[model samples]
Target: MVMQTINKIISANEKINDVLMNQSGLLDVVVYENASYDLNLLQAGQSLKVKVSLLGQNACCTLRTVYLSGTDADNKIEFEVIHAVEQTNSKQEIKGVAAGFGKADFYGVIRMPHGSQKCEGSQSHKALLLSDNACIKCTPELEIYADDVKCAHGSSIGTLDETYLFYLMSRGIDETTARQMLIKAFLLSDMPQAFETEIDKWMEANE
Candidate 1:
């Protein structure tokens, strides 16, 4: 069990990306000021835990996860974020697609401790099932111990939308192409542009 720790002071209006791939360990990160942080997780297995802290005014943090599982594969990810100061914001989004007998689980928690006023936090988890025996579970929790703060969380699991698929097919797009496009859109919607090439390679290999 390896532990990675990162501590940094972000200047105003700065943005950074922290990317992890195929790792089974613990990660800790902290950021300050009007900066933005993007935490991306791809193809993780075994178990992973991420702890993030946002400090200073008008800071923002985003956590995005994309996972693909096949038969007998078990993947799990856990994330915790703390808005330790006022006027901070945080978000978590998770997308997964499972096939065969694969199983995936995601647990995310956002905390606004006492005295951390005027903060905003949100989390969303969505998964697609590609086979009858595939399973995915998501749990999002929010703890707001301060006043004048806003928080929300949601989870959803389903297959692709047939109506959207049909609409794409009606426009001269092949079914396979439409499905691939939709899957890519779902998994990469919240990702940064710098990750486009890597995500494209992953999609091509999986396809």
Candidate 2:
């Protein structure tokens, strides 16, 4: 198993692959602070599984860490698998958060070739908006050239529910903390179950 988390301001392209089988390949990814990545490529095979999580914190104007306010921040992730060559397929889960006046974009593409049969591929992207001025763009794409493959993709961007906040506040939870906790939970929805420890550490830091 392999685990990796990106927690800095990234400005270049990157390529990553997770191959899970008897070897059990795994990955837990987190994009924190002012972290930024452009033209990122991710590949996973039928025998590989990976969980990706992204959190945007302190989109404020601080001297040490400049706010993430770039107009040309491009992030693209492509996950493909050839299932016929292998079986008992893999899984890919992606999640993200965008707050304040910051901008976020995610593009996901999952492909299953013609000969690949009985392969399962699922991809999802979700974002939270803290301010009305915040901007987020999501594109969930799937290319299936095989008839016997199961694949799906979904994307959503929304704000915290007022009713949920009210319920938490009634239980003695502060409003601000309630909102943060909800956002944190939403961003962590897609993370794999096996990486709970890493997820705990990330929540501690991001929250």
Candidate 3:
């Protein structure tokens, strides 16, 4: 397994994108005040473990993943984060779209280890199913071992919202355009602007 350690001081309102693929490794990140992380995963297999330590107050972290697989592909992601100090914040939003007969799984854990007071953490995982034979699993776990901390997690698996699709189509948008818009919103809404063009090309090629 490979291990990487990153330590940085992010100025206010700065955003960074960390993208990884096809490896088994451990990542350690320290986030500072008002800074954010856009963590993206593509075509990942084997094992990927990430641990973020929020060191400064009001530091924010966001995680988003997209997995496109074929019939024999097996992809998995494991993520963990800790609010190391007081008043830090983190959010994990993982969006996965699965097609063919492949399997995709995401496991996330957030912890506020002792003395990390007033920290807030939240995680949500949503999967889009495009084939009857495809399988997608999302497991979000939280361990709060501190006082005055708030944390929550959620998981859901479903196709696109047909009601919203119909609503957009009724407003003169074609079906294809409406679908693409919905997908882009779901997967790219919180991504950093620097990565938008690359993600757009990826989405078009995969589509």
Q: Specify the highest-lDDT model's number.
A: 1
Q: Return the lDDT, model 2, position 98.
A: 41
- Structure candidate 2, residue pairs in collision: 20-47, 20-48
lDDT of 2 by residue, 49-110 (tens): 32333223211110000011112322223333223221223344555444444565545555
RMSD per prediction, one decimal? 3.0, 14.3, 4.1
Consecutive 10-residue window with the lowest summed lDDT within model 2: 58-67
TM-score of each: 0.81, 0.54, 0.73
TM-score sort, best first = 1, 3, 2
**Alpha-carbon error at 119 in model 2, in Å?**
1.6
Cα lDDT tens digits for candidate 3, 52-164: 87877777787766655446655677788888778888888776676667678788999898888998999988777756887888878888889798898988889879999
TM-score-better candidate, 1 vs 2:
1
Q: lDDT tens string, model 1, 111-145?
A: 99998899999898888886688888887888889
Clashing pairs in 1: none
Better of 2 and 3 by TM-score: 3
